[model samples]
Target: MLFNEEIQRVFKSDSWKKVNKKLIGKMLSEYMYEKMIQPNILSEEGENIEYSLQVSESKHYHYIAQKRLFDSFDVKWTTIYIVENDGRKEADSAIELLVDLQDVIGMSSETAGHLIKEMNSTLIADAHLLEKEAKRSDELIHEDYASLEGYMTGHPWITYNKGRIGFGYDDYLAFAPEQQKEIQLSWIAVHKDLASFQSVEGLDYEALIASELSEEERIRFDVKVKQHGSEPSQYYYMPVHEWQWKNTLVQNFPEELAIGRIIPLGKGEDRYLPQQSIRTFVNITNKDKHHVKLPMSILNTLVYRGLPSERTVIAPKVTEFIKGMAEKDHFLKEECRVILPGENASMNVNHPYYTQLKEAPYQYLEMLGTIWRESIYTYLEEGEQAITLAALLYEDHHHKPYVESLIDQSGLSTEEWMEQFFKVVMEPLLHYLYQYGTVFSPHGQNTIVVLKDAKPHRLAIKDFVDDVNISDQDFPELQGLSSEFKAVLRTEAPEGLTQFIFTGLFICHLRYLSNLLKNNGLMEEETFWSLLADAILNYQSRFPQLEERFKLFDFFKPELTKLCLNRNRMVDYGYSDDDDRPHASEFGKVTNALAAFQLNRTVGSN
Candidate 1:
């Protein structure tokens, strides 16, 4: 009865069926790409293929799909049908297909059961997205970055992307990014003995607090801290998500609260909006203020959206390391002028019991921490706008891509716009990988594209605490790195390091953009990929001295290991509470689409 109004408004039968069909199409396409399903080809016409999959003796699914490069499929959702002994009907249930494929895909019953909840949650979110007052691509192109994120759909590849396990409907309405709700953050005081605060060389706790909180709010918070019989100087003030404080900290840290080691200090004066990541918040009251990242215990995408204790402790150091490189490199500082919005400060509070317990579940250890990242607004020049790379994949209610609107507004042909896009995004990423033996997981959310006159002008990469990785191979650039950094940051082999860019950016994001553009008749699929290949090659030509490193981190190999996100949760790492978080699963190898362009370049030159 409480959510009767919401249920009536958002959960219409027609909307459910429509969102389910779209999700079914996504499941079929992604499952095929991951090699989880191999349907027999019924017929073929050019790049279009008709396939039939038999789930049971009498149950069959038939659909026509456009076969894209990277072994991906774009299934025509309306064309999908389920054939049974009785008759034939439109395929409209994603959960039904998921259950039917459980045994076929070797999913355990426990995993299947959990996946059902996640899939249903995803469906509810999708229905709300359908019912919300949607924006057009043209209008959204001019919107500010903070407000624009709410219009986006979640991850392009993952099926259960919005499966926020810990959220009730009330929490979703209050705090979900798509809800576009702005609320003041709740502050907590942790005794200095139990909390650790770190920051860049020039900034400290006092300066950070002064910048973040108004004098009146600080006084009120200090008075509350004193009421709990603790000196203001003996404690560190940390901003926390209201949901995290209510659901996670109260139950987990009861002893600390009872002893007055942790005190609730009420809400701050500034209002903030949650971003797509859900854990990060942007200050809506003051655009230039630092964006706050707090630990939320929701299970979304693959892992709990909590900041690991080790990463939080070392975040500022990582910021200094990355920003220091850009300060010294002439290309990064002057020519390309790439932006790195640093995670300049952080506060981490480890659970007393979890810290003492060996091999405790990771979720328990990461329950309390905060990272303060420099605002993206601080870096924008006049006539410049910043949007996350994910915005490009967004489709308006009319199914027009946001990127297409930007291209139209830029007064550039699709090819010209895409060329500038690749140069802006790839040059900085490649320079970091080839020239300096470093890489960031430049996935949609982590990478930001700065646009000028509606065309990409530069790149901004963030989330250094979680995403930045280094090459395992010894390189002079990394020789001076401290052992503390070596312990906190992940190190990868040559191919593994290259996968961060190749699979993270090209395969995960650009492939979808290429498909969208081709389907919309803006550009051919081959031309789209060829332009990206050209961008990488041009960067290589500029830095011939890094030829050996280029080969070591080659992006044009004939095949590379295929990473699967859905398969990771459903087949390999189910709902187990493990000491470490789950990662993307590696299935068989996938043919490299860029390799063909490289061959073409070689033959044309010869």
Candidate 2:
């Protein structure tokens, strides 16, 4: 009885072809009966069917109807008329009813609202499930990979706990434990010598007369007594050349000798290396009065040793060139050597390079020395060798055979090393950018990749000058650097020098990481991107500088997120849609909603 001639009109339209007309009509009837007739019929007592009719006439029903019928369609069509007729006209009218019904139901507000809500809920749940899966995957990765001790403040040496993959620094003496004992022994010996000597009791009258003897007379008497006290079998004193005695004094106690000392200057510090030494040229005036002058060579070495090998080479060369210019320009050496310490104390007595010069002269002889040591250690362990500039680039390590041997034995490929290097150094850096609004640029030769235990694992990021970005207020000393450094490190600039580093080191290296991981079957393409997105999101959540404007996860949105979500739904779940166009549209809507949520959250917090 509810089947009107208008329903026939709905069948003629193009919208009717998109869906089964019978199914649509059946669903519509079901919904109407459930809302209007069934509830009223099931009611007891004085409840009226008229009330159900009134409810059906309510504005909400019409609103839902409009939404379900019209908003649901990709292309919209309006309902024009509902006609009823008999005979041949009835069949024509039936087709017309189908056509009109097609437009109305195809763009249904109720259906659209139901589907949108259902899809959104599913996506949110999927995102949460994906997050859980990612966390589990991360745990698996950590389990497979070896862990090393991380650096800590206020420690002399870090403990590399092999089992737990934990690290900590304690109050470690700079020298080896045995070496420290040796130093203590030396100090005790000096104290014992000082203890044994006693002065003549009270200088009696006879003693005074003995003391009053002329300098030559005293020397002769002293010589005679020394001769009498000598052993009978052998003379105690041996003849020495006058030149030898004079030369000994001159060489050992020269007017300008390089003074160096190994001491623990800072007290109560843990993990302090005794290798750090203070060295300077001391001008000995009358043995007591001396002037301490710092040297450029020593300063350069100190700074160099503190950096990675790659950076050490570059920094020293630049520093040496600057020093040469300064010397030519008659610049005061003191000005060049000045260093600002934490306190207001100006330390002019010690050379700026004293730390390196006194502690590890051999270590700072050249940049190649450090690289050689690292490579040799890897080679002995039978790990993946490092491809140094020597073999691949056809250049020897400063033309040194020993250095070349170290590189050859290491057996690490440059590509592998670079891959590891980016992971260790560049990953943390991008994370820093997300959190702190800045990072150090580790471009050029400042980057180093090292292989360990047959797997490329270590990445050394160097060059703090062009790399580190601290707020101007926090690090006023940085103001002395060039304006380029300042601008690149600024928070406001997009695609600044800092971003260049991110794009170069992090984004570009992603492909390499993917290849390596995929080759080993460690991760698939979808998993790789998901992992990357998770890393970025985690970094942003932790750092969150200018979070409203900065969206690190956005980079992976349309590609990675869609792929993961759509793939999972299509492959695992049976979502059979003929066009497949709805999937993309669904993703777009979801992205829009997410963006809106982010914006709203930002606004609400403010």
Using lDDT as the measure, the top candidate is 1
Name the lDDT value of residue 135 in candidate 2.
23
**Model 2, span 247-305: residue lDDT tens:** 22123223212221111111111111111111111111111111111111111101212
| Model 1 lDDT per residue over 1-606, tens place | 789999999998899999999999999999999989999999999877899999999999999999889988899887899999968998989999999999789999999998999999899988999999988999999999998999888999999999999999999999989999998999999999999999999999999999999999999999999888889999999999999999999999999999999999999999998999999999999989999999999999999999999999999999999988899999999999999999999999999988888889999999999999999999999999999999999888899999999999999999999999999999999999987889999999999999999999999999999999999998999998888899999999999999999889988998999989998899998999999899999999999999999899999999999999999998999999999999899999989999999999879989
Q: Which candidate has the top score in TM-score?
A: 1
lDDT of 2: 0.26
RMSD of each: 0.8, 33.6
Worst 10 residues of 2 by lDDT: 152-161
Off by over 4 Å in 2: 1-427, 431-437, 443-445, 449-459, 465-492, 519-522, 544-606
lDDT of 1 at 18: 96
- Candidate 2 C-alpha error for residue 298, in Å: 30
